[model samples]
Target chain A: MIEKKYRDLIDKLIQKSLMKKVSWNKSSRETEYYVHFKKGSFTVDNWVNDSSVYVDFTLRNANGIEIVSQTFEKESNPEEFNYLFKLYKAAEESYIKVDETISSIINELDEEDTVGKDEEDVLPF
Target chain B: MKRFRDPVFALIVYGIGLIIISFGYYFIPNDLKNIVNYISITGTFSSVYGILVAYAQIMSVRETAENTKLKIEKSNKRVMKILSVSDLSKAIKIIPEIQNYLSADKDESALMRLKDLKGILLNLKFIKDIEELTSDEKFVDALNELSIHSANLSKAMMGTKTGLNKSKIISDLDNIENQLNEFEGYLKYGNYD
Candidate 1:
């Protein structure tokens, strides 16, 4: 049996991992969640009929990461759906971390060049 | 305790003996029965020898066919890997050059570079889609890297043209460069086997 507590933890992690600009929606048969960052968007869905969850997301810069993840479980419960939503949120948060980490590294590279160019522009003949 | 049976081999030996005896009766005189018997024995041995030679030829043909198939598969994999890596390298070389020209505010040169980059990226995407035709992991990874880099470059250029925020454009360019470098590492070190 899958523990509800673990599922909840996963949900929290996904939520924290994503960018803050995320939205959620729910219907009788399905629920959808998404997050949009500077360059791309991440989305996940849970279907009531199959008791399954699917995730699709993209992270782009000059290089981009696109990922799709899906998992199915036998039992259906409101609690499980709630946990899945949390997981989706956590995944979005995680993606943001990865994006920020890459962005920061690149930013560091530009810092030196940018400062040098600024100084050159300010120099008097 | 029962007798051991070698049904097929036994049947084949018996059939050969019968054929030899019949040939001896038809071709030799009864007065020379001893000579005919010797001739029959020789004929039986010759028939067995012919059968063994035929079986060996069939096995060799099967082995040749299998080897040819393996070689063709390997060659196909090698060709696919080369094409994929070449596409990736071209994209990496072209995109940043175009971005730098744009950043330097050389509109005319940037436009020309953009055209070149776009054409190369389109070609890379096409190659990635067809990568499934060959089962070469190195080639697939290279093609994937090319496709990703192309998309990032496209986004960066479009951001620049559309007057997106300066910081955003710079960020996108940085991401593109990182992707290209990662791709280069894969190309240099990725195992083809």
Candidate 2:
């Protein structure tokens, strides 16, 4: 059994999953989760009926082309939860990492702009 | 009060009186002159002592007024900074939402919320700056503690899921929320206990 804390994390993941652009095939009764990033997106395709839960974690390029896909069955697979949790976390970290990187770049560019302003104050001679 | 408060004026008056007494010495009868001399000498000493005591009292009152003014100014600054509790309360309200976004894998939204939080913290930097400038050690230390916790929260928010300690994040959030609540209470009721 996942701890209450991990369960809560899972619950939150589900909430976000509900928000992302999802693709549903009525004939197959399959729902796909698409979480977008700057360079790529993570997609979770979940197929569920009364008896079993099947899940897939797919990495897609910026254009939504699938680059990789891993499928797991709930009854047959215990490692699915671990992988799901990892991807959820990786998605979070990558967001922060990308933001921090962009912020630093902006800061550097600002510093350079300030330097340019200072240089403008000096005579060419 | 004005006459006695001026030491220079008091001294000038004493000098003129002494000169008058000296001039009157030659006019007095020989037998009464000695008695007049004694009275003049005693009266001069008493007048000088009175003037010195009055000057000391004036100086002390001025010093006390200056000290009171300084204390009032310092407390006024403290009250001004404390008044910013409202801003802090608003900032505290954003933490939970940031956590929600981060958990749901909404990186851009979470980052946006984090940026908002960072801006709020930066706005409150003036309070820290004032506390440091005034050498209000107790308040400066408290503000420093807040800054450290805020940095930790930002780090945890940006940290990876595998490495993330949800409990720690929750605790830190609790600590920050509790602190802001305390600040608000203190501001409202003027009670620190």
**All candidates: TM-score:** 0.41, 0.34
lDDT agreement with native, every candidate:
0.48, 0.53
Q: Per-residue CA lDDT of candidate 2, range A11-109, in tens?
A: 665565444422211110113324434444444445554556655555444323345655666777757655564444444444345556778878888
- Report the Cα RMSD per candidate: 15.2, 20.9
DockQ of candidate 1 relative to the true structure: 0.03
Error of 1 at B90 (Å): 0.8
DockQ of each: 0.03, 0.01
Let me know the TM-score candidate 1 reaches against the reference structure.
0.41
The share of true interface contacts that also appear in candidate 1 amounts to 0.02
Where model 2 places Cα greater than 4 Å from the true spot, the runs are: A1-125, B1-50, B115-175
Query: Ten residues in a row with the worst lDDT in model 2 chain B?
Result: B133-142
Q: Please give, for residues B90-121, the per-residue lDDT of candidate 1 as tens digits.
A: 86676667567657765456556545644554
Per-residue lDDT of model 2, residues B58-151, tens digit only: 9878877899998997787667656566677777798788678656856566557656765664455556423332233323333332332233
